[model samples]
Target: MDSLRADAYLQHIGVPRPGTAGAAELRALHLGHQLVVPFENLSIHLGQDVPLREEALVEKIVDAGRGGFCYELNGAFGGLLAALGYEVTLMAARVFGEGGRLGPPYDHLALRVAAADGSGPWLADVGFGRHSHFPLLFDSRGEQSDPAGVFRLVETPEGDLDVLRDDAPQYRLERRPRQLADFEATCWWQRTSPKSHFRQSLVCSRLTEDGRVTLSGRTLVVTGSDGRQERELPEHEVLDAYRDHFSIVLDREPQVAPLDA
Candidate 1:
């Protein structure tokens, strides 16, 4: 990526350039990106191709002003961090799926960022929806608190670490380092398979200062510091909500598929 494109990414996330990539800088970047970009799989619902390449990911998220699921979001984020001279490794994780079952391998993409001061690695994930509001210390066993929830990482008997949010198991993370290409098959499955939630639901959501705003299918759900609100939107109103809330302007109404068991 060129310096110009890098500047565009910083602008997209509303972040000023950090002279050096440190833990504090990484934390700020993580929060800023999450606040600006959304966690959505609308492209999958719209039957659009979801590419896993860093350049394509950047084009969609930063250039095109769109959001994507884990692959696109984390892939792009990892690339940006790498460009900024941070020691970032793409790590694979298995998400806790329907019925509390663990999904297949490479179900998610996260980052292991080494501290600029050489303290240790920290888990920085901007792609997980409703997860920790900031990065969590990788080696710490104690509970870490964030605006999203209280999180704890515990080592399991199987040797993988389990990430728990508010005492609920979110996912078991493998320590093994992985490349972005390792997740390609799972990304394809998620976009195309009927069993995948990304293929079923149409949701576009982003974190707000107070709480969150989401458009699920035709329903607009908003939860703020004040309270929660939910209402069904008419077809025309749906597009308006996407534009107004998510800053996404769609050419046509997105096709939503039914969720499969």
Candidate 2:
């Protein structure tokens, strides 16, 4: 990523270029990204191939004004952070599923960022839907409280870190750093495998000032301090909801592809 692209990414996320990349700046960028770029998996259903390369991810997210799942979101965000002088390392994680079973090797992608001001080594993840609003201290073992939830990083006997939210395990982080290409196979599996959850549903979600608004399939769900409200949208209104809520304009609404397709 170049200076021009970095500036464009910052503008796309509605954030200002920080004079120094530090903890505060990291928080702002993390939150700004969460608020602006949605966590979505529409490509798989839209019959679109999700390329894991940096240039393709940037074009889709920044230039095309679209959002993507973990690999694309963190991959692009990591690039922008590195371009802005942050020491960014792409890390692989295995998500914890039902009964605490760990998923595949590269089930998720996150960033271990060392800010320029020496305030970091923070776990910066903008792709996980409904996760911590800001970066979490990487080395902190105690519970870190955020508006999203109370999070804790527990070091396992194997030296891997288990990320927990509100006392529930989210995913396990490996110590080894990874390259964007390393996730290509699993990224392919995520989008193509019939068993993948992403292939089973369509989701587009973003954080709002007070809460969150999500479009899961055709059901629009809004949750805030007051409470939660959900309503199913007709086919005619689905495209408008995507535009109004996520700034994503699609000619046709993405539908779940046939299992054999």
**Index of the highest-TM-score prediction:** 2
Model 1 residue runs over 4 Å out of place are 258-261
Looking at model 2, report the run of 10 residues with the lowest lDDT sum: 192-201
Q: Which stretches of candidate 2 lie over 4 Å from their true place?
A: none
Worst 10 residues of 1 by lDDT: 252-261
In the range 27-146, model 2's lDDT, one tens digit per residue, is 999999999999999999988999889989999998889999999999999999999889999999999999999988999999999998898689999998889999999999999999
TM-scores for all predictions: 0.96, 0.98
Clashing pairs in 2: none
Q: Residue 34, candidate 2: how far off, in angstroms?
A: 0.6
- Per-residue CA lDDT of model 1 for 1-261, tens digit only, reads 667778899999999988888888888899999889999988887778987888899999887889998888888988888888888888888999778899989999988888676755889898988888788999999999989889999999988889999989998899999998899999999888888877777888898888999888898999997799999998878788888998888888786766652
